[model samples]
Target: MTETNPTKVQLVQVDPELEGQRIDNFLRTFLKGVPKSLIYRVLRKGEVRVNKKRVKPDYKLQAHDEVRIPPVKVAEPQELPSVKLNKVANLEQYILFEDDQLIAINKPSGMAVHGGSGLSFGVIEALRALRPEQKFLELVHRLDRDTSGCLLVAKRRSALKSLHEQLREKQVDKRYHALVSGHWPASRNKVKAALRKNILKSGERMVSVAEDGKESETRYRVLQSFEQATLVEAFPVTGRTHQIRVHCQYAGHCIGGDDKYNDEVFNLAMQEKGLHRLFLHAYSLSFMHPKTGERQTLIAPLDPQLSQVLKNLSHA
Candidate 1:
């Protein structure tokens, strides 16, 4: 009967209402804000202790079992449960933070996280090439190849597993900066809708609001208002595919330069202002350290291109 969202470790003695449910799915519903993969990781790692012992992801709950659920960190995407600024348009190495457990880089726009779909190499591939001495490197979560900002790479499987669990439970805090068409209302603060994903015959992925889709939400705070555009901070409360972008569109404000979901006239105006890429940037990521259990925040400085666009808008 526990109903409110859990913000820290939890110990729930099973009852008749909770029995017979699979642990993973049960965690999915209990920690409704988290990603699935991270939930699975914690199960595999025994982070979710049942009666002080580990259980399988498929383990069925019993009425007497005592469940120990760990605290979660939240950061999400339509997918970032998951970059930076400046200098020579991303030619310079943008290492925001690095430790033995993970690497945070200021990912440039137009670079895939991993190679596939006619790409020979991407960021993960390039990092592997640069760090031959390291034996393990993997993305903890993902960002759109077109979106530029902080992306994390785990140095060890243990770290990956730890971060994944944290991500699933919404323990990581993620923030994005975006420029959207038209003036945004000060009273409008959130978008709540169901999102469905579709793949076109051309293999392009598209997401839209549909009744049968998964529940999704994105919270917005207007940062600055322009005559024809608004700059806002986006927080994806529920990670559905392209949740933030679609939420904006559902609210009648398409982000500038979004190729798939865009306003042609609005985009043209943005293009004239030198916005050739998506105007969304994952500017900041705050999360708990997998190793130390302390919280950390990584800041990705805006690249010169994005900075210039803001400048141009301000002057105009």
Candidate 2:
């Protein structure tokens, strides 16, 4: 469907490319420039219809379903990210794997996965800028702003849907490496706790163990031990927000350089050993390929700074 008279209603038919997509999500693309509040307003007022019937925002559009889009003023196009920026241009060098359906990148720390919340652009925005002609690109999963690891991006809607199903089925495996200091017992290989997230008025998010919170579990294996720090591989059984960071804190071995959920004394001690950021990294991800149906395992090596901190501790 192409742009029509802004004052006129447009009837666009759904295609297989957007099959199974929610009505509200489809409208954002269809009615680009329309405010989100207005999109919901039209839906709530029954101005937007599917198959000549009123549908809720969550209605899944099907092939050939006609959508009645009410005329709404489109805003001026937002400025696109400049591809020449070093952060955007250099992303290609970080690509660990790529295929027809998806890509795997060893995301750098301190960069948000997707733009928003005061960030003008992020990895996804940069990727989109890099491939202007690519029709569809979306994140298969997200990594925290400070946690670097294997992040997935789908090239097609089908691929995104497939990978999401695999994740829901627990068929995806992700392993992370974290550097912490304290008495880490080999016998305490796993942490099973419930966590609750709290939002401070300052807009900061914090997660802590709470008996009435969501159940979480993480299995750990010691990689190396040192008087200053301990390196361990953590496998999260359930994907919860900040599960690994909070779990490490609960175990009394808070990850070094963790500004949140960290022990101040331990952080100061770790800083002396050259650890300056959250000492957490996602090392690998294993999953069945959405397009090929074959098992795929992707690995990301520790970055130079992180690797150097480990070396620094060895000699400290």
Candidate 3:
């Protein structure tokens, strides 16, 4: 088997017992989990060398030939497999901001924020595919897949570190707009509950308000009202998992189409009206520039479908 931590090639003194094997086969004996196809590709690209000279995969092994290998780095971001964009074609107009230091995308519902849970691609993957020259793009923070809003990404490592620090210090300001079921009793409210992680059947982590849960705080105010539902602006004081959703639920109002923690009947009604996902949008974000320390704010208007739903509900 190949070396477990092989970053680059190293010379080895040949033992008489293994002298006559084919060079490729001999090399494969030391490497584990590496496929022959990849080995061949590396060889064809002149990444493998014997005695300081590039050699064919079929080259014969010599007793003491010094093998050289170019250092192996993780596959470049641009070279990753493409993420098809057919599903999100309508949401393309939501890119609210982009710059050398940051990228802000208005993510839509039914799309994942990042690749995990057997998913093959996500918005970041597609972005990397579109911009091949950028060597790094790191997520500064995350919003739920069903939560539409301004998602931030840093273009460089230093920027990522700085942005994360800002988030920890509560220096970034985030606002979300959500349409929730039931009329709220109060126009302004604050929910101060702790959130505890719950495990779902699929082994995914969920959140619930519990007495012993981590501290979370969410402030909300009514924006508009329909007959049975209301739109509210929410500002979370602490970045706890599912803080807004749990706090809203505790307030006797739940965001529409929040399947994970919402009223099923209400969710179904919204689905019938073609509102199949959560009615939550990350409406605004403000933070100091990671490099220059200048204040910047990004905003994303609601997706057209959500806006249309609001209009229909208003007419009702």
Number of the top TM-score candidate:
2
lDDT for model 1, please.
0.83
Tens digit of per-residue lDDT, candidate 2, span 43-146:
99999999999999999989899999888878765666899999999999989998889989999999899888899899999999998999888999999999
lDDT of 3 by residue, 1-316 (tens): 2234446566665454345556677656544345677777888998778877888888876767777755543332223444346644433455677778878888877677777778776777666666669866768898987888899988875677788889999999999999888786564588888899898898987899899999899988888878768889999999987789888888878889887779877777777666777899999999999878999988888988898888778422
Off by over 4 Å in 2: 1-5, 51-54
Error of 1 at 206 (Å): 0.7
Question: Which has the better lDDT: candidate 1, or candidate 2?
Answer: 2
Clashing pairs in 3: 1-29, 1-30, 1-31, 2-30, 2-31
The global C-alpha lDDT for each of the candidates, from Candidate 1 onward, is 0.83, 0.90, 0.77
Give all TM-scores, in the order shown.
0.72, 0.91, 0.74
- Can you write out model 1's per-residue Cα lDDT over 1-316, one digit (the tens) per residue? 2234447888988765456768887788666567798899889888999999999998989877899998775444122111122222242377788889999988888988887898766677677666668866889989998898989999876688788888899998889999999888889989999999999999989998999999898999998887779999999988777888889988999999899888999999988889899988999999999899999999998889888888778521
Model 1 alpha-carbon drift over 4 Å, by segment: 1-92, 314-316
lDDT of 2 at 56: 96
The Cα error of candidate 1 at residue 236, in Å, is 0.4
